[model samples]
Target: MLKKELPLKHIKINYDPIIDTPLEIIAQYPDLYEQKIAENGIDTIIYDNDISDNVSFYNITYALNKDCMMFMNLPLEVARFSISNMTDYIIQLLEKSYYVQFLCDPYWVSNYVSYQKEHHEHPMLIYGFDTVNKYFLAQDYFDYKQKTKQLVSFKDIDASYYNSSFSQLPDEYQLLNACVLHCSKIVNTKAKEINCDLIKQSLINFLNCYSYTKVETEGIYYGIQFFDILINRYHNDSDYVSL
Candidate 1:
């Protein structure tokens, strides 16, 4: 049996729960984390909102390319496609240096709050594999237990991932996200430096009330402007305002 391990760290992003798992997972990579803090750190923020009144994020998404690796989120069925055995697929990914994220049924996962109690679906991140022990190193946030790094048996992961309900979940709820921290040896001998000029321009863009056009659709708000939107929404449509 082979064993492979990667960084599995999570930091609390108090501003937005929507991106907590993904962004915190991103923080585990050294180069990405430092660059993220240098520019897209908390002080520079963007708030994204939809007509449904859902407020998703309160910080900027530099989309710093995930170190130019891969990140894809698709419905479970779409994700599985030719792949079989969820646990095996996950180990395949981990062996290739990719961290896997999927909506795991915590009820089947030991050390989980709902383990053996109730079925609740939430994003679970798996970053390492111990084939000899039949366990995967995972990170998950549970309300009652507090967030922790856990060792989950392959049996539990398989059961949690292959649960029947996950297939029936709505498009937004059914997701399997995988990301890799791309690696390559540096050519230059000098120490790395943050792009101060780019950071400056980003601030200017935020201050000038620029909206991110890369959004999937029009009318999605971004940047400092969302503060006004948040205030108005809270006053006018408090019932719909959600984080």
Candidate 2:
């Protein structure tokens, strides 16, 4: 197959581990995300993985709920290509200039350098692949290291794919927890350059939708009011009073 590729888009916000995968995938389409944010006054957040158990991200931050257009946490099927064998499907996505994110075991994908049979689920954005050469070009982000884009062998990818803990649990070769985003739907949103004002407003919006009752019992505090409380306490401390 002819090589298909797209430029990677770097994320702009302070990264949060809970939502990093979806943000990185969305970052690949900056124009679309920006346009939506400008016009709709919100980001169209979508998730394929069930993050309901992530109480902080889902309930407090509203990352998965606010401005959500659509979300499904079920297995996805493509009519043209089998999810079990994504080579053809991925190539087609590349041909159409779509970013394809795949879930794989880090151990096999990195040739066991990252770990030994750890089966940790990781997301990789595949941009281009050469069928004749039997390799694919992809990018990955790690918290402790700089982001990287590298070419990996098809055999290694296949091994990681089939060996993913998500797939092995069912004893079948499948794309586990696969999610694809279509941002074109909200592409017409007004584009506003990110600034301090926008950041403040986004925080306000987040606090408005979040229910204090749910997290208040858990001792999770946030927002400007909480900040004031912290500031007052700091000022009252004997250490600061002497200073």
Candidate 3:
């Protein structure tokens, strides 16, 4: 008989001290970091300060699934710090059952947190992502949202490079193409297990077909997929999964 997929149990967290520690030193002892999370309830820790924006925190979140606790310091709003670099760290340290909470605003950076709370999903957030922006551009609907403005807007140089990089990904690996039929079933079933609309939408988004005809809908669809993949990978890893 095939082995059954187990529920998530814990999450692993990695922090980039250089980037996350803040120049002022948030905690006297490194252990204090973990202690704080414990005070709030969390598990596992790693430390780093350099990463890439192309990387996604959801990757780490999914990898941990519901098996472990994960934590990290809030990403800095300063331009000297790299979002991509921070993203890389987030992706590497994800775990299951662990919440990757940011000690930041809820409105701009709280979508992941909101999704988790609304869904009782595997990954949870203690804080939210930052929403302060240094670059100026024509304001759009997304710009009106602090979180979106912070998370999505990029420096012109970074934006061009990222667009090119995304364009080069294999069609199968493209955000929309990552899911196979089997993965879709796994996600849908898991969403029910979690009893969350956010999780359900996330699963649906990941498995959606990429269609040029529905560009606007596809964007929303892709966003869900992005987070779903992050949660799924973090939660479903062998180290976190028990037989």
Candidate 4:
């Protein structure tokens, strides 16, 4: 079932970047990524740093989807699919030049943490699968020490999927779907360019329309007004911020 690996590599790193799994996948599409930034006037793609100054989280997925791709969910019976069927499904994706993103329990994929003793859902990108060698070529942006890609055994992945605990929310499944990315379809299509003036106006309109309760008990606020309050509290009160 093994075929070919997409000749893709990490083009850049948004230091201490936002840990959004979807954004991590979007990062691989460098040209489209640049277009998004250019259109939106995103000075920093990294999210953790400038929370107050930017709108990185605003309509990001919509923008990406509008650009050049779609993630179609895959169906598999976690309790009944034979290993051969599962592997064949993955190999077919590789053969068609598509990347598979699997949401699995992190416990089986890593040995560094005691996550194996517990269940936690995580998304991993699959770039290549080898039937003869018995491993899947995977890459993770969540690792702090290293950003390069690595290989994971197919057996461990299979075990994790079968053993995952479905969440209370029916929409929030444990083994979630094996979504395949049709990046090949977007090879010639360019992401729509951002109109900086429009973005500015949108931000202005959002701020004008923003409203929220300030009661500390309510625990929520929105817009620049809230940001001012937060900054003031951080400077004036020791208990206002927490590590």
- Give one digit per residue, the lDDT tens place, for model 4 in 1-243: 444675443312121122324333223334444455323221212122233232232232211222222223222321122233545656676676555656556666662243466455555667787788888777654353554477777777776655544452135332222221311111212323323344345435643553323334343333344334433443344221010
Show model 4 residue runs off by greater than 4 Å: 10-19, 23-84, 111-115, 141-145, 167-186, 189-243
All candidates' lDDT scores?
Answer: 0.45, 0.42, 0.25, 0.41
Clashing pairs in 4: 39-194
Top lDDT: which candidate number? 1
Worst ten in a row by lDDT for model 1:
179-188
TM-score, cand. 3: 0.17
lDDT of 3 by residue, 30-132 (tens): 3432233223211112222244211121221211222122222222221122234433222222212122222221122223333212211111121112225
Question: What RMSD, rounded to one decimal, does every model reach?
Answer: 13.9, 13.8, 21.5, 13.2
Give the clashing pairs for model 2.
Answer: 38-190, 39-189, 39-190
Which 10 successive residues of model 3 have the least lDDT summed? 177-186
Please, what are the lDDT tens digits per residue for candidate 1 over residues 171-199?
54332222221111111223223233443
